[model samples]
Target: MPKSNVKKMLFILSKATIENVYAAFIMANGARMEGIEAEIFFTFFGLEAIQKKKLEHLHVATVGNPAMHMPTMLGGLPGMEALATKMMKKEMEKLDMPPIGEFLEILSDSGCKLWACKLAVEMFHLEEKDLIDDLDGILTIGDFYSRATEDNTQMLFV
Candidate 1:
């Protein structure tokens, strides 16, 4: 096969649900594995993935998730979300997927840039200490866009 033209991948994660967070993580990791530059911009609720305390407690979105094959009412029941999150975590463990905290470390060690959104940090009243140690730093949207100024760079929102 011919070599891929893509040189870099930029991912914007705006959701905190475990599934959405993992999607961005997996894709960015894949890009780095292929020797492509990768970066993740965490904004809105996505910041939870990079928070020191919240990362470990991220849960699956059981309610209103049609893929769960359950009624919305059933999903809303007490403990349903916890149960679903538990099951998902078990499956992820089987697949050798690391938990959020370790995964962030791996991404950082592998040279995948992790940036928190400046506006979101301010809105959430978060200090730098509130974020994961692996985070590169907080950045404005314009600063993030400037990182994408290379040819064959691609951006994705998750």
Candidate 2:
């Protein structure tokens, strides 16, 4: 690990939850504002957070999510997640937050690096071409671990 003046903030996103992705981006941006080198790694369902086709359709877990205070059984109900997603979007809009894609674009422009997981891409049969254009790169778990373990690199999973 190389000694540096700035810290590396690594956020590993393994879910597709709207809140998770939003929080990661928000934090990454915040870290950059403080002069940190921040990056977000999208893996598993989290890949949906960066996929071009799934960005706007992202949703919060409506049921079986302790945060939502709903029972697990309710998660099986159709359209609940969708309903929650709509409500969340409306609330965010009221607060003047940009849509997911725009948020990503702003983050990218702000120098927040974005990466996708290699294994997850193959497991989910995803094509790199379908992801947003500004991603830093697709990384294997081993490579990610090595980089994340560098001195002053803090790994956060959401």
Candidate 3:
């Protein structure tokens, strides 16, 4: 047996919320920068980030989150999710942060693998056409575990 120099990381993202989705990308990109091999498997609500049909529906929190406060009840209305997302995007832009889609593309281009969970796809009735084109493939949990079994590999659930 030989020690492997490369580190393998499996990131499981299940939340579609803005911060959670962004955090997944941040971690993936960071891992790549550290010379680690990283794979992200989007499942459940997290699928929205890679699904063309649902990508635009991603949202941020303007209210009810302990860290944030809504100035008025109207600020927390049903349509406010979009507003909050937009506001957050603008703030990120000002900070020169990469958009979620662009960040994912960069990660793929840099050799980090992206996968959509097969069980989630079937459960949501999602077809291949629904996913972003950058995904390396659709994988089952067993498939992911097989890859993550290598020495020094780390698995994360978010």
**Clash statistics: count for each candidate:** 0, 0, 0
Model 1 Cα lDDT, one tens digit per residue, 92-122: 9999999999999989999999999999999
Q: Compose the digit string of candidate 3's lDDT tens values, residues 1-158.
A: 66447588889999888899888888888888887889999998899999976775678866667565656566677878787788898998998888777877898998989889999999999999989999889999899888776788988998
Q: Candidate 1 vs. truth: CA RMSD?
A: 0.7
lDDT per prediction?
0.96, 0.86, 0.85
The 10-residue segment with the lowest total lDDT in model 3: 66-75
TM-score of each: 0.98, 0.87, 0.87
Residue 32: error of model 3 in Å? Answer: 0.4
Predicted model with the maximum lDDT: 1
Candidate 2 per-residue lDDT over residues 1-158, each given as its tens digit:
66446588988999888888888888888888887888888999999988999988888877667887778778658988888889889999999888989988988998988889999999989897989998889998777777765577889998
lDDT of 3: 0.85
Model 3 regions more than 4 Å off:
1-6, 71-75
Residue 49's lDDT within candidate 1 is 93
Q: Candidate 2: which pairs clash?
A: none
Candidate 2 local lDDT, residue 64 = 61
